[model samples]
Target: MSREPYRARWAGTDYEASADLVDGRLHLRLYGSAPADGFEKVAPGRFVRAVPAADCSAVWHVTTVCEWHGAPFLVHTAREAELLIEYTGGDALHAAGLGLERIERGVYRIWVKREEVSALSEKLVKIVSR
Candidate 1:
């Protein structure tokens, strides 16, 4: 990925989510509200929709994913606030490189590797002594 993973962070929260376009398709991975199905056309060049938590499984992780192939457009939504992402040229992935190097075009392989790290961060906690 690039410096920024095409994401949306609202209200100084770490639970920000991001999205990318793979071969003219939307690949959204976020830990908040599940994006709505399809965009509602508000005007000739505007669309609006909601990414609500419609199911139990969608409560966490990236739950919203869609595919669109045309002149390209933008998705405007939020988790607890408003966010925006434009699906246009360069934003869409044409190819990817994994273990064996660059994979073929239009081929997307999702290999999620999970590792266990106990002390990953140090956050301030309110300590009360009695």
Candidate 2:
């Protein structure tokens, strides 16, 4: 069956957007306007939220993923990885070069150098998660 396309405009020209109902997600390409900070310009990911339109249609925003910016390194062992998973730091910690990708749990991986790698990861997680 045919579905109604969502309409939007970008760069001054008019455009259209469409979606497909897949196993567990909706996928689409879109051009549109949003609040100044409505979106981030990074690469896309799976998560999203729907905003209700006046007429009850939905607007989709690609959600951000959890990622710690491990400056200048990579996790080299299971013990280090385990340390990262168990760490969570807070405000006082942020100033110490630590943080977490709190939007969601980023079990992805970690990067680090010698000294305080786990401390850094824990501190960051607390700041963002809190």
Candidate 3:
């Protein structure tokens, strides 16, 4: 069966990210950095994908699992992804109740509440500004 594409949006802003799940994994392709107050481009990274622990690295085992619509999604789903975002400390949305939904084949949608987005954005700004 084919999976759907996924999209994620930050509340109160045009900032967003998109990815797809193929062969039981989600692929997040980072194009540009978000345009928040203190968002800094740490390093130039390319396409990264997330997959089930059985298929990917064993490190993914330590990540948390989030449940949405009775489905469990992995937080920091991928090792490389987790490190990349952690370096910048900007992708903390995963901890702020970010929700993901499969919209259609190879498509998925991620939603973050306005309040949480604001708080995350502020935290990122503080870190970057320092």
Best by TM-score: 2
* Arranged by lDDT, best first: 2, 1, 3
Look at candidate 1 and tell me the lDDT of residue 14.
30
The RMSD (Cα, Å) of candidate 2 is: 16.7
Q: With candidate 1 superimposed using the best TM-score fit, by how many Å does residue 106's alpha carbon deviate from the native? A: 14
What lDDT tens digits, residue by residue, belong to model 3 across residues 1-130?
0011222222222222335566766543222343333344545532232322222221111123344433334333223223111112223344343333434443344543222221121111111110
- Give per-residue lDDT, candidate 3, residue 11: 26
Q: What residue runs in model 2 are displaced by over 4 Å at the alpha carbon?
A: 1-52, 60-62, 69-90, 99-130
| Segments of candidate 1 deviating more than 4 angstroms | 1-5, 19-30, 33-102, 105-130
Which residue pairs show backbone clashes in model 1?
A: 35-51
Query: How far is 46's C-alpha from truth in model 2 (Å)?
Result: 22
The C-alpha lDDT values of all candidates are: 0.30, 0.32, 0.29
TM-score of each: 0.17, 0.19, 0.18
Residue 9 in model 3: shift from native, Å? Answer: 35
lDDT score, candidate 2, position 102 = 39
Error of 3 at 114 (Å): 11
